[model samples]
Target: MDFGLVLLLLGGFLLGGAWSIWRADSDTEGRTGPQVVFAVILLTAALLASVSGILYLV
Candidate 1:
């Protein structure tokens, strides 16, 4: 129940979702460069955040 942990998870979730949207947009626009790299990084961070959150809750 640490506030910092909660913030971490929330931030990760939001960033992941935002990146997902942007990734989709980039895909539709046919651009493959920094956006793709950023999307990957965000998704990875999101996954780590979710796992850490679950562990913290336990």
Candidate 2:
């Protein structure tokens, strides 16, 4: 339970949240540059967060 690990996981959540918003907005606007990238990055981070969180809880 290193503080640094917690911080890193939190950072991933923050990045994912931001990217999710950005991706959704871009999708709504019909843009396709960083939208997909953000969406993918967001999903990756979310998955990472879920795994990290589960491990932390365990």
Candidate 3:
């Protein structure tokens, strides 16, 4: 399999997980520090992976 494709898949999964976490956190009384931090990290990683994947494919 292509490395670019793998990156894209991984990015998608990470993005989904980040979104889920953010949504869940929002539904609660207040945002937890750890969950917010984790979600931000995941989102940043996902964006980086997705950009790298796209660049690789180009």
Best by TM-score: 3
Pairs that clash in candidate 2: none
Local accuracy of candidate 1 as per-residue lDDT tens digits, 20-53:
7565764356756776777777777777776777
Ranking by lDDT: 3, 1, 2
- Model 2 agreement with the true structure over 1-58: per-residue lDDT tens digits: 7754685677577676866666565435675777667776777777676667667666
Q: In model 2, where is the ten-residue run with the lowest total lDDT?
A: 20-29
lDDT of 3 by residue, 1-58 (tens): 9999989999999999999988885555777999899999999999999999999999
* RMSD (CA, Å), each prediction: 3.4, 4.0, 1.5
Using lDDT as the measure, name the better of candidate 1 and candidate 2.
1
Model 1 regions more than 4 Å off: 1-12, 15-29
Between which residue pairs do clashes occur in model 1? none
- What is the number of backbone collisions in each predicted candidate, taken in the order shown? 0, 0, 0
Model 2 misplaced stretches (Cα beyond 4 Å)? 1-29
